[model samples]
Target: MSAERVHRTTHDVTVAAPAGVVYGLISDAVQWPLYFPPNVHVEQLEFDGERERLRMWATANGEVKSWTSRRVLDAVARRVEFRQELPARPVRSMGGTWIVEPLGADRCKLTLLHDFTVDGDDPGAVAWVERATDTNSTAELANIKALAERWANLDELVLTFEDSVRVNGPAELVYDFLHRVADWPELVPHVSRLDVVEEEPGVQVMSMDTLTADGSSHTTESVRVCFPDAGRIVYKQTATPLLMSAHTGEWTVEQDETGATVVSRHSVVLREENIERVLGEGATVAAARRYVREALGRNSTATMNLAKSHAENAVTVL
Candidate 1:
């Protein structure tokens, strides 16, 4: 047989970050390389003031593959559409969707749907493309989920805070008021300082200063904070050298027929760099879990009563 006809391949991923967060990150055009790595280059071409067209070049695993594609944003649907400008060896058509859906008050489900079409008259190559899509897609999704989860999880190094409070207020009102971190300094005691480094619609980077009992102070930089709506604010500590463990958590207000509870939950993971220094290689994962639990507890109840009160009062004022 001669050189086989070229074929297409498709891959996808389901991330844990809020769909809107994933969608915005994917659509930014500038941050694409940061997510996909060195193989891809993205450039912005035109802007209608709302959405812009992006040109992208992606290099496949080896020298045999390279192609350029143009993508447009469906901002209302929070999706990106791509069309190939120049076909390489096998890919006849390729495009995908990044989907975000609400799972509950504090969590969301992210899905990536990629489609591909193979070209040429050879029946074997086309069949190969069809057969490989499922396996490739599953692997792709796993990689995406790991990346998205890891990005948010890295923020836990220095600050990890989560707790639930029973406030005699409506959930929506409580959720709206908790979105502002500026009030945190005034309300939360150990939180001597809190400032917004920058704001982008629903997401922000917040800086915080905490005082120790010995009159010393510790400062953390670049906390990833996002306000999904009136009632939920999620934050993760940006990766830092000083942090051995990282955490990601959310603040959510829910009111059901029975009553409402303001729930705060966060997941913490260890950074491989600090694995040996903080917890020796032989240390059990259980020990790490306990450390995170205690750290979270410090920020709850007595430590976070002010935040609860702040949310309560905010409900009243609004």
Candidate 2:
């Protein structure tokens, strides 16, 4: 009932913000990609009250790794505890807890705790854990602190841009066209390659390579959670573009008397430090914003138009 060998690490950060704001960031595991730097995608597999199962992909020690975790959420206690369903190699067991404590009005203390055990005291393995624990825990704390403090003015750091097209056909046709991203490589001109892996129903991991208007290319990975009944698919990019430090968005279909509207909403947070190097020297945030908006808008508009054509020309099943 107990682990043979044990190792532990703890990281604490004090933030000048309310506990609820910080806790909200941690409690919503699906949104981690948007708030936490290392998190690429988190898919909720099952949830019932305080118990939940999730699949997460994240960068640890500078390498990407995916794992399934079982979590126990305690909202009243402001705490969450989780453990890997199947621990990674060289480890017998892995578990962690997050706790948020209120210091006073507009102040809080966040704590991250990790407990684990390896086969033996392999220095290399132990060192890796130490480095990862320090790096990721500290980063999650710092990100929450900055986001909470600037929550009111986050528009300066994060931006949401969208493009939509109205199709003169049934909503089901439009939804089906957008949902089948695997067909985009052949159907959409800008999409050079699209690979999708669906290990479970309604949850998918996709890798897409896109060519922008300027001919520059980039590959991005994402996890998408589909809701056919609602005609919505929410996705978070695990691998982001050069200008965006993190990205998450959704595809939504809305129907009215006229027709159906398919929309692509992209929410991006810029990497200020890389702006000059990425966009060339002396490029400001404003310049980055304009450049990114135009580039993303072009691709989205292209996809929506493609969808519009497919829906308008195809036979409607609904």
Candidate 3:
């Protein structure tokens, strides 16, 4: 057993937006990677309306760490509270609350509260935990504030789109196709070269070269998390096009009594400065939005169809 010494940290920021908008963003764990730099990915293990269990990965103190957390959503109070179920090494316990208070018709304050305890009475571990909490909390507030207030400018930085196709195969087969991304070059026509390394089971670092419509290629690197049981693979791009500041996506296969379906989701945050240079002059966020839908959306559709073909064709072999 380890001694418990608690440390608490809290940070708040005022945004020029309504409380509901801020609350909605905080409540959606699956969308964190798109909005929060510290969060790499979020896995929804179980969720009822008011309660949820999630396994999440994030970069903290310059290293990737993962933990499971349970949260209670108080919609009426505009608050969410969470406690870690499986704390990482050196952390005995960690929990936090998010509070959103509306200031007026168009302003609100979002407060983040973090309370943590280190294993034993190690001062070094306590300091490390405190630093990480402060760093993450401050960044989270700034991101929320920026994203919420930007809708007013009609210049929303990030965009998300979803596409799906019916597959006449088992969900497992479709999941495997997406999980084994290294094989994409051999299977996906648009893919010319691909490489995947799994330093840890179910987590992968992948880089791929994809041919574009103009006969050129684009290379992208991403970290992927696979949930075999759920038939889901979530990924966030580490290297992206100049027009994009951030990119994250997911592939999911859902099974029903009839058959299965594969869905693809893409979220992109565009760089305003590069829009006109890369997408041509006079290009606004709207044009950038359309460009992403066509450029990124095309590849997602292709991947979905190819995976569907391979899985469905192999169904009889099962």
TM-score of each: 0.45, 0.68, 0.81
User: What lDDT does model 2 reach?
Assistant: 0.84
Q: Measured by C-alpha RMSD in angstroms, how accurate is candidate 2?
A: 5.6
- Tens digit per residue, CA lDDT, model 1, 153-250: 53433233467777665666555556666776776677799887443465556677876445656675434334455466655454322333334556
Instruction: Please estimate how well model 1 matches the true structure, expressed as its whole-model Cα lDDT.
Output: 0.54
What does candidate 2's lDDT look like per residue over 41-141, in tens digits? 78799999899999887667755566789999998899999998866556667899999999997999999999987766677787787788789888888
Give the candidates in order of lDDT, highest first. Answer: 3, 2, 1
With a 3 Å backbone cut-off (N, CA, C), the pairs that clash in candidate 2 are none
What are the Cα lDDT values of the candidates?
A: 0.54, 0.84, 0.87
TM-score of predicted structure 3: 0.81
Cα RMSD for predicted model 3: 3.5
Q: Point out where model 2 deviates above 4 Å.
A: 1-9, 13-31, 37-97, 100-109, 114-139, 145-154, 316-318
All candidates: CA RMSD (Å): 15.4, 5.6, 3.5
Model 1 regions more than 4 Å off: 1-162, 212-217, 222-230, 240-246, 257-259, 272-285, 300-304, 311-318
